[model samples]
Target: MRWRSTLVAAAVGAAALLAPVLVAPTASAHGWVTNPPSRQDHCSTGAVSFDCGGLQYEPQSVEAPKGSMQCSGGGGFTVLDDESLPWPRTQIDNSVTMRWQLKAQHATSTWEYFVDGVLHRTFDDHGAKPDAVVEHTVDNLPAGDHTILARWNVADTVNAFYACVDVTVGEGGGTTEPPVDPTDPPVEPGDCDVAAWDPAAVYVLGDRATVGGHTYEARWWTRGENPTTTGEWGAWRDLGAC
Candidate 1:
């Protein structure tokens, strides 16, 4: 009886909390940063961004007020831009491709990338109906820890989609220390052989495999090669020699 009562109470509480969102208007905007990993991107991919919010469930819905290019859109998401917070930073090379996933194409004015408050590069899509997948390459960013803001300026509307990506530009591409709970029981790598890093296997971001008594997760899609022999750019990330 006690357990049932507790469960009922918890259910009621949760329903109450979600009541607003469940009844709220359907969101129209749909897009998010995909490469170099915006906060919402990290959450979408099963990685934690430290100070994340309920936006994890609806990353593409993070819409900011028009004319405000701020990260987090100005409210309920500014934590994404909160420098004081310990956001997970993905490692990348100085030159990286920034990509965005738009659920629907829009006439774009311009797409801009900014690093440390300085404009790095801009892709002019003025009057162009961009594809759902938008990409641009940014080069010459000095190697170091940095935050990037990718802004999508709409041609017709006064609004823009904003995403902040935390990064570390190192010599050999970059790496990301996933913010998995340290308190969770450590996962043990099985006896999978190092040969498990099959060259013919096509891997994608967030894919995991056990190899050589350690667990290695794929940072990006790869196939047909031994990553251990490759340099840091290898798509594999070693969990440890467990």
Candidate 2:
């Protein structure tokens, strides 16, 4: 009986020691830039409207180690590192307001912005948690086409989230489109009169909602997902701007 108890205790102790190693690491936070639209954002939102592999469905999953200059953070989404793709460059002034939509929030260490491989701006959180929406205004960016790499570092982990936004700064940049107003009436007549999208609303297949002056139809059951953020391969299909 004594020997049996000892063996059982040893096995239990060994299991406890191996527990942390056996479990896989996962991100405590997930997010992406949406205003100017990151690479994954464009893929998820149908702005680019092309196949973007798994990244299309998960714009917020680009997590890797804390220090990488690559757009994808050298993570599994290697397609983001490809510069040849027809990535849309948003036209903007020298100063731009960057916005991030966080699917999950964690204690943040710092938020970093790098422009064309140079560190441009940084917001240090000092191990504080963040809100669902985070915004920062970066000033004095040089003119012409440039890539801004944004990194969100978690306070307690070595991992960080990455988003790349392409922009043409100053005059003679890309075509500038006016911002959409949610209060504006539908531009197209017929079938555009739908309820506004509610993040709390549960939607089934074929359900429709209007958001950001656009209409979207749910392709499957979904909840808590913003219609504008869920790109082309997401649960909602774009019905064109209304």
Candidate 3:
């Protein structure tokens, strides 16, 4: 399946802004913490699921017959399925360790861990719990934003697959905490002059405008010349310049 680069970028931007959640994100300079991977990386295959404190996009139910993995109930929330090593976040030194708490909807399903989308570890989840801790150590992780993802090998309605990661950056470094940025997630993008249906397909052409509970990008459907029907497509009439 193809992933929408635009939406993915938006999600990453959202995650980046979620740094000041106050819970410390189960992270440490050199210690280990656990949580599910971000939702952006799994949007192509996962759905929305509860993680850490808020919510994250999780993997969709694995296709049955066509694939070995399958979700029993409608498929549990998103699970960790990262495609990069030390994903989710980076910039760590030697002495740091990271642990992820994986939760599965089905207790009998086997949960798997991936680094850069590669299988690194596996566990047999026996209990259908919301928070299950999986530990891993980080020798060195590239500094910058990382895409960490996790999912279940077998999907069952009764089971859920999740990963809550805990990252410890430095062992003894007193001031080696990862840089923190506190911001709020952007409200949903809005339309220009009209309210268009199925924004997933097309957005009006115009500059962005935000107001009330919506954010609209003023987009023009026509080029330089004005068309007989003079109005904006994706532009919002309520919100001004965005």
Task: Kindly give the number of clashing pairs for every candidate.
Answer: 7, 3, 68
Model 2 worst lDDT window (10 residues): 172-181
| TM-scores, one per candidate | 0.58, 0.60, 0.26
Candidate 3 residues lying further than 4 Å off, grouped into runs, are 1-37, 40-105, 126-146, 153-155, 158-242
User: Can you write out model 1's per-residue Cα lDDT over 203-241, one digit (the tens) per residue?
Assistant: 776666666567676665554335464334345566666
* Per-residue lDDT of 101 in model 1: 92
- Give stretches of model 2 more than 4 Å off: 1-29, 172-242
lDDT of 3 by residue, 35-82 (tens): 333333223223333331122222222212212232111223323332
lDDT of each: 0.70, 0.82, 0.34
Worst-scoring 10-residue span by lDDT in model 1: 172-181
Q: Per TM-score, what order, best first?
A: 2, 1, 3
Candidate closer to the true structure by TM-score (higher is better), 1 or 3? 1
